[model samples]
Target chain A: MMIISTSYHIFVKEFVSEFRTRYALNALLMFVVTTLSIILFSIGQESPSIDVLSGTLWIVIFFSAMSGLSRTFVAEEERGTSLTLRLLVNASSVYIGKLVYNFALILVLSVIIAVSYVLFITEFTVKTFEIFWLTILLGSAGLASASTILAAIIAKANTKGTLFPVLAFPILLPLLLTCINATKLATEGAFLVEAVKEFQILISFTVVMIATSFLVFDFVWKD
Target chain B: MKTWLKIAVSVWLTGIIIAGIAFPMVKVPQTWYEFPFIPGLEEKARNIIFHVPISWATVVAFAMSMIYGIIYLRKKDIDYDLRSVSSASLGLLLCILATVTGAIWAKFNWGSFWNWDPRQTSIFILLLIYGAYFVLRSAIDEEERRATLSSVYSIIAGVTVPFFIFVMPRIMSGLHPGSLGDEQGKGPVLEFKMAPNMLMVFFASLIGFTVLYFWMYSLKVRQMRIERHVQQITETH
Candidate 1:
């Protein structure tokens, strides 16, 4: 209980720090806009319907999440503040803090991408709000597990920038697989039951990764 | 090298002779030569001889590397790290060999060398993941940090190997051979005469490849240790 609540607070604080020190979100916003503009341009005046919009939005979300992850846990190391974190917080809490911050960031990015997708792409709007929100919820949480865990791994490495992607991609494959499917279903305006298996898998992926991160973060931090 | 390897060479040569001449003559099932194996698998049996052994050998190599990685972490010994890297190199070689052989076999069987099937894609992904581990190691300087990070990466990557090799394939559907688990290269496989003699040959080959892996791993560690000494001496001078 103490671990969960305290970590949640610390996560918010670290997120604020990430916003200030890293300017990660600002850079990511630019990347997102550039990506969409390129997609729109390359798409060549043939306005991509809602289907293309959903894919473009997810792609932006994934890349921004990945780039943001490279900086996720490094702020503590940058300030030599890991020791302070270690002294006060359980290692798992620190991981949770990082996880929560990453989840929030990815979720917000998804929303921005979603809105941009609607504004820029087509007349197609999400028909059932539940499907749209559910896809976002599962996809965001799933992305957090892959991003935050990989960030912890890369944060400890000598070359965080290079190693993070190599490590993250393999781990993220299954989650990405499910997220794509879920998004597909939502885009097609299918009922939740139609994509139930993919959603269940997404949920399981999120849980297992978060659980493994909790266990593995202890070693990642102590080392 | 000759004087030192006399016993090993003699033993290997003797095993080859016995396997090539006597065993196949005596114990193989008569029907093996009398009939075809599973309709059109006759020619492909030759592939099993190379492919299965290589994959089995590579899996052993990966496990050896992983063990050394754990040892390096446990002892903080660079010698073990060298062994780990060398074993990984061997594993990578064998993995590539298996992929190639598998691709050729697929071209023969499935009518295409490359299909974006789950099995094919997952194996390719695993290959990239390990290749990237080497890239990650080379991107950094400082032997200690490199050793530590590479060792860590190897451990993590090695863990994922089985996840893709066994678990991922089972999770989805695919046309990859040896996928049925129990049917992997046994009974009426490509090597028709696999009765008693081929089994012996197969097992012997598995053992022989394991020895080769250890020999190369030892040599690599020795070279790394010498290089470390040379660097240290030059620095002191």
Candidate 2:
């Protein structure tokens, strides 16, 4: 219970700070829009297949994550608030706070991505909304958890920009693969029942990621 | 290395090399040649001597690296960190060797240097995972911090190696051969199709590769330890 309130307070702190600067949010929107427009312009008047669209959607989400979520811990580092925060609260609290914040950011980003895809891509259609949305939710959670931990990691490194994605690609491979497959099924109007395996994979990936990151966060955060 | 251990390794390596080249030429009954093989793999199947053992040795080295990484995290000893990197670099070298040998075998057997098979895909991902480990190492500056962070990264990366190597390959269909469909052993050996002579050479190669991997690992660890000691002594002066 104390952990929850501490985490919530930290989340609120970050949220208020983000609202004041709007740095991450501004960067995220600009990136999403620019990349989305570029993709739309490149495919002008051509109907890409569902597989291409699915792959493109994930690529967009992944890179957008690379651009935005990397800032989660970088902000603390830049503000010199990391040490102060470290002294103030438990490591798990800070991790949970950051994790939740990133999760919300990713959820919003996914919705924007989904909306942009429908408006820009000519042939994009969601036959199985339930499956698609479920994938978005689960995939976003997995991506947020993964990137948050990794962002914490690279935040302390020198060449952070390059290191973040390089470290992320392999870890995110399993999740990305599962998401693409599920999205394909959704695009093809497959039953929600058919995506059960993908759901299980996403769920397990999220659980394992959060559990392991929590176990190790103390070491990473404190040290 | 101890004289006896050095002598043993050299002798073991020489015996395996000689056996690998010579034993395959031993007059096996015609039935041995009659066994099913891929189109151009008849002679190329001999690559199993190098390819299979090198692949196994690479996995062994990776497991060694992860174990050492775990120990480093727990013990905070820079020596374990050195051991971890030593084994990792050796493992990556073995992994590259496995890929090259595999590509050569594929060129002869599958008729293409790159087939994008599931096995190939899995190996490629394993390479990336290990490659990322070094990238993470280089991005950090401090000695102890680099050791700590890289060890944590190593354990995380290690979790994916098994998934990529074993589970992903099984889930995706491929032309790499040996379906291993609920057979007795792991991989092609499970098919139990090899001749007794082939099995003997295979075992010999496996032992030789394992011995070679450990030899490289120990040599690297010693070199790094000496370098660290030299650095500390010179800095103190």
TM-score of each: 0.80, 0.93
Error of 2 at B150 (Å): 0.6
**What 10-residue stretch in candidate 1 chain B is worst by lDDT?**
B20-29
Across residues B5-87, which tens digit of lDDT does each residue of candidate 1 receive?
64684587467445534432322247432222434454464455457767777778778877887787678878888888887
The DockQ scores of all candidates, in the order shown, are: 0.31, 0.57
User: In candidate 1 chain A, what residue range of length 10 has the lowest lDDT sum?
Assistant: A211-220
Q: Report, for every candidate in turn, its global Cα lDDT versus the true structure.
A: 0.69, 0.82
Error of 1 at B50 (Å): 0.9
Chain A of candidate 1 gets a TM-score of: 0.89
Cα lDDT tens digits for candidate 2, B1-237: 566877798998797676655543433456442323323345566777788899999989888888988888788888898998998899899999999989988887668998778778777887998899899898888998888888777766665554444336434666665644323233664254666656776787888778877778789999999999999999899
Clashing pairs in 2: none
The TM-score obtained by model 2 is 0.93
User: Whole-model lDDT, candidate 1?
Assistant: 0.69
